[model samples]
Target: MIQAAAAILKKEITQELRTKYALNTILAFTGATLLLILFTLRAHQMDPTPKSGLVWIIILFASMTGMTRSFVQEAEKKTWAFLQLHANATEVYLGKLIYNFLFLLLLHVFTFFFYLIMMDMAIQSHLYFMSAIIFGAASLASVTTLTSAMIAQADRKGALFSVLCIPLVVPLLLILTRVTRFALIEGAASGALNDLAALVGYCGVTITAGILLFDYIWND
Candidate 1:
């Protein structure tokens, strides 16, 4: 299982390095969105609530753009059948999940840094805010990775991806936004524990569920 997963992960990383499809698309979209937000709100002061919400909003759409192609590319190139022949469902799913998680982590870090600089968003508790970002990215990656696999064979993958992901990710976004807002306020450490816990729990649940159900989704 480990070797199979590693092979798949290496294949994904190699393909991505060669083609740069997902990375280029995600970076371009993120840059355009950040520029729009910066120009649109240059004169106004955004409170923490709206600021935090906007950060996740950009992340949501950016992730949708990049991660939706996870399995769809395989299916489109007819390499999915090749993967199925060589790797078990669990191996494929785990490899994809790790790849997505790492990709999202990098994207989120880039987004957060630019968001802070472009939007002038300040943080009071850098530690807490970074924690929320980590768990939030994990949760998003887990859910979207599974959804990408499930919708690999769909005709309208982009539309269906958003339709399926939005409802599933609402709770995650809410928790992330709340925690991020808490992290922005001075001495608000006590309030973020619950939200952080919720984010962690959501990540755990989604990952476990994705692992358990991936075989069915893959083989279907």
Candidate 2:
């Protein structure tokens, strides 16, 4: 199963390199949105509280632009059927989950870095802020990966994906906002200890459930 997962992961990477569809879409959306926010809202001059919220909002929406591609692309490209046939459900899910996590983790950091540069926000706890980003990314990735699988076969994938995903990630977004506040406003890692724990717990639950349920979802 592990070997199969690795092969799937490698396939994903190679396919992404060949196509660059997801990466390009994410970059375009993220850059354009950041530019709009910087010019229109003057995010750099916004209040600290709102700035933290803005960070997550941008990251989440920007991710939504391309995160669904992992599965949707497979289905569209007619590779999903191949995956379903050659790989067992668990292997496919794990492989997809890993790719999603890695892509999302990088996307979070990229969006955060651009936001910091554009906002000129000072950070006292780089470690804590980065930790929060990691946890937040993982949690969101886990949930979206599962939801993407659920909607991969649907016709109106964009609308249906958003409907299924937004409510599920609300708790994650709230926790992320709290942690960001602590990192950017309170400037204390201690202030966000509980939120960080919550993020970890959420990630564990979602990933575990995803692994357990993928076989059923895939086969169904």
Candidate 3:
């Protein structure tokens, strides 16, 4: 299982490196969004509440822009059939899950770095903030990965993807925004721990559910 998943991961990384399609799109979208925020509010002293909200908002929208590409590309390129034929349910699901998780994790971190610096906001606790980054990526990846697979089976993947995703992700964005508030304003304050725990639980539940449902999705 591990090896198969690793092979899938390696295949994905290789494809991404070769074409740099997803990476380029994600980078450009993320960078432009960050720059827009920087320019719009660079002068004002933005409070941590809205600042944190904006942080997750940017990540959320930017993530939406690129998250569907994994499965979408496979369909468009007609490699999805080959992938389905070659990989088992678990291998395909796990491989794609890891790829999305890692890809978004790095993107989250990069956004965090530039966002903090560009906004000239001081992070009260790097660890707390990073906790948000890791779990935020995981939560978004978990949802997007599974949704991508489900939508990949449909004709109107683009519209269906957003409809299915936005509802599921709203709660997650709320939790992340709350934690960001705590991280930036109060350090690792007591209240933030609950939100972090919520994130962990959200990841666990989504990933587990994705694994169970994916067999049917992949084989369909």
lDDT of 3 at 218: 82
Error of 1 at 139 (Å): 0.8
Tens digits of per-residue lDDT, candidate 2, 134-209, equal: 8888888888889989999999999888898899888988988888888887877554777878888998999999
Provide the RMSD of all predictions against the true structure, rounded to 1 decimal: 1.4, 1.4, 1.5
> Which lDDT value does model 1 have at 42?
58
Would you list the clashing residue pairs of candidate 2? none
Query: Model 2, residue 144: what's the lDDT?
Result: 87
Quick one: best lDDT, which candidate? 1
Q: What overall lDDT, based on C-alpha atoms, would model 3 receive against the true structure?
A: 0.85
- Residue 106, candidate 2: C-alpha displacement in angstroms: 1.6
For candidate 3, the 10 contiguous residues with the lowest summed lDDT are 40-49
Q: Quick one: how many clashes does candidate 3 have?
A: 0
The residue-by-residue lDDT of candidate 1 on 29-100, one tens digit each, is 998988888787652276656887788898999999999999999999999889889999999998998899
Q: Which pairs of residues collide in model 3?
A: none
Question: Model 2, poorest ten-residue lDDT window?
Answer: 187-196
Ranked by lDDT, top first: 1, 2, 3
